[model samples]
Target: MALQISSDCISCGACEPECPNTAIYSGGTEFEYFGKKFEALASDIFYIVPEKCTECIGFHEESQCAAVCPVDACIPDPEFPEDRSQLLAKKVHLHGS
Candidate 1:
């Protein structure tokens, strides 16, 4: 499953640079996919783009964001449940193997 930043996020921007897929976005900031832009998921806390997140499966043994998070606010996203293979496929789709 993709990881989601909870309301507990401190908005410290710690997890932003740790993401391999560039799925983490600052609060109130917009993100783009292909040629389409989307609104921020959280206006006051950092959010993850489920479609672009692969839990760092292709790039790391664990989610980098969670590993580096000081408050453990990064958790699995129930809304976008996915298995290892699926996550790997998403990784390939995002960045070629």
Candidate 2:
């Protein structure tokens, strides 16, 4: 499943750089990917894009953003449940390898 940013986020910006898929984004900051432009998150909180998230497969043993988040703000996205094989597929799609 795609990882998500929870309300517990302190907005410290720690997880942003750790994301390989660039799925983490600062609040109110626009980001473009997959040929689309997504409006920045409205809240002054960290956010994660489910479409771009791969649960760190093919990159790490676990989600790097979640691993480094000081407040434990990053968590599994319940809305987008995915298995390991699916995540691996996404990883290949993102990195083309």
Tens digits of lDDT, candidate 2, 1-97? 9988888889999899998899989999887687789798546898998878998888888899989999998988889989999988888887788
Supply the TM-score for candidate 2: 0.92
Model 1 CA deviation exceeding 4 Å by range: none
In terms of lDDT, which candidate is strongest? 1
Q: Which candidate has the top score in TM-score? A: 1
User: Each candidate's TM vs. the true structure?
Assistant: 0.94, 0.92
Residue 35 local lDDT, model 1:
64
| Predicted candidate 1 versus true structure: per-residue lDDT over 24-43, tens digit per residue | 99999998776688998878
Model 2 global lDDT (CA atoms, 0 to 1)? 0.87
Model 1 TM-score relative to the real fold:
0.94
Instruction: Give the whole-model CA lDDT for all candidates, comma-separated.
Output: 0.91, 0.87
Off by over 4 Å in 2: none
Backbone clashes under 3 angstroms, per model:
0, 0
